[model samples]
Target: MDVSRTRVLQLIARPDFPEPYERLAGGSVWLAEDVERWITEHQPWKADQEAEEEP
Candidate 1:
C-alpha cells in the first residue's frame, strides 16, 4: 500500500476518471474508495509479498 501523495492527488484530479467515492476539499474532488479498490485489485502481488514477509 505504498503510494506517493502527488500521484494520489493527480488521480483525484483527473476529469475522465470513474471513481466510485469522492470527497470535496478546497474546491477539489478526491477519490478515496476508488483508490482503495485500485490498490486491492492492482496490487495483489504486493499484498502477497507482504504477507509472506510477515510472521
Candidate 2:
C-alpha cells in the first residue's frame, strides 16, 4: 500500500486492471480484493508470504 499516486494511475490505465467500483467526486475506487488479486498476478515476489498469512 506504499505505492505512489503516479504508480496507481499507471496501473489503473492498464486494460487488464479491474474496473472501478465507483466514481466519486474526487476519483475512482476499486475493490481491495480485486486489486490484491491483480497485484499477486503481476508481482509474485511480494506475495511469497501471503499464503501463510491467509486464513
The digit string of per-residue lDDT tens for model 2 on 1-55 reads 3779899889899999999999999899899899888878987666766766668
Candidate 1's C-alpha runs over 4 A off are: 10-20, 26-34, 50-55
User: For all candidates, what are the clash counts?
Assistant: 0, 0
Q: Any idea what lDDT model 2 has?
A: 0.84
Per-residue lDDT, model 2, residue 48, is 62
Encode model 1's per-residue lDDT on 19-39: one tens digit a residue.
544346645453666654554
Using TM-score as the measure, the top candidate is 2
- Stretches of candidate 2 off by over 4 Å are 49-55
lDDT of each: 0.61, 0.84
How many clashing pairs in candidate 2?
0
Compared with the true structure, model 1 gives a TM-score of: 0.34
CA lDDT for candidate 1: 0.61
Q: After superposition, how far is residue 7 of candidate 2 from its true place, in Å?
A: 0.7
